[model samples]
Target: MEPLDWNKHYDLANLPKFDMTLCWNCKAPATKVCSGCKETRYCTSECQKAHWKKHKAHCKMFGQMHMMGELPKIMKKNEPKYKGPSMGRCSGCNVRFTPNYPPNDKCPECGYTACESCVVHEVRGTCHCTNHNFGRTYCIMEPRWYHKNGKTGEPYIGDRHPEDPLHEYTPDMYEPVERQCNNCKKITKVFKKEYWNPQRFNTSWF
Candidate 1:
């Protein structure tokens, strides 16, 4: 997604006060609310620029609302809701299923149903998750092995072992698995001891 041009929507007098008191940019006391969205705040221009990448989508939506002169109405409509399960295909695997499927959970923002496997994969960083707000999906990085003698202090280029053709490597040999978030598409390094949660974590996603 592209960054929003906030300069086009800078009208402080027309902007509303954000419900939160803290700045979304620096978590400091905010003195200004984003004139474009009126939903985000920043302590200064530098902070706003730093947070623009994460806030652009919401900012653009609000800008659209301002253009239509329906900011209030649209904000109310976009409010989060507890949407019980509805019949639909899994957002992750695109498999069709009923609401009663044991592995389904509906998105509160978009009413999209994600199957258990897909949700597991998302949280575990094995695959991508659908973003209802953006009408698109984000993906996690794939796992890779590093070479022993290749360039040091630089990106790793995979090295082949003599047994590559005769033996299979298992992930169990590694300590802490590296996974990525589907929402932010950022890598998360997790240790088995600290991140393991039987209720929410599933190895099947790997």
Candidate 2:
């Protein structure tokens, strides 16, 4: 039987890049890229083998993106202007910090940190360690439909700072909260103020 493809199964989108040219296990200059995913690089086979346990999940994810023709898009590095704070790095993924969109997830062990896809429980849970918190600092709030201009009452559509104001939206509005699904009637933890759209519920709550 074939292994599960979570991207397809979960309708996942906006995958991350594994295209760094340095050794994934150590930050040495590398010439060898993982044959399996053609994304991660390693200085030697030893480094590849050493990193396999941790890289396994990311390797599989990148390989899946390749099979689905999504690899090119991820590897392109078309990042938008930085909208988040100047957090140095993510102790979890070791990548530079980026925006957490909204309802940012703060690492339980340390305060006000965000990680790659911190919104996901499985990913978020592994973000803290003995030495330091793997999550970065919360920088900005992503615009949401519920955020209305104070005077115009129109939906605000831009990155928001903590001090910024929209009469209808609060910084904590997207923080995870429990809500009852209108369609299934099952209570689930959702980003606060998020609406349920049955068709897109599996992928997002906008």
Candidate 2 weakest ten by summed lDDT: 130-139
How big is the RMSD of model 1?
17.7
Candidate 2 lDDT, 1-206, residue by residue in tens: 12344556454464433437678788789989888987778999999999887778777776766666864676566766333333565433445654543334554543334553643433333333322223321123233333332123343332222223643443454445555533233464333434321232322533
Clashes of each: 1, 1
Task: Report how far off residue 23 is in candidate 1 (Å).
Answer: 0.5
User: What are the lDDT scores of the predictions, listed in order?
Assistant: 0.48, 0.48
Superposition TM-score, candidate 2 onto the true structure = 0.27
How far residue 201's Cα lies from its native spot in candidate 1, in Å, is: 84
Question: What TM-score would each prediction reach against the true structure?
Answer: 0.23, 0.27
Please report, as a residue range, the 10-residue window in candidate 1 with the lowest summed lDDT.
144-153
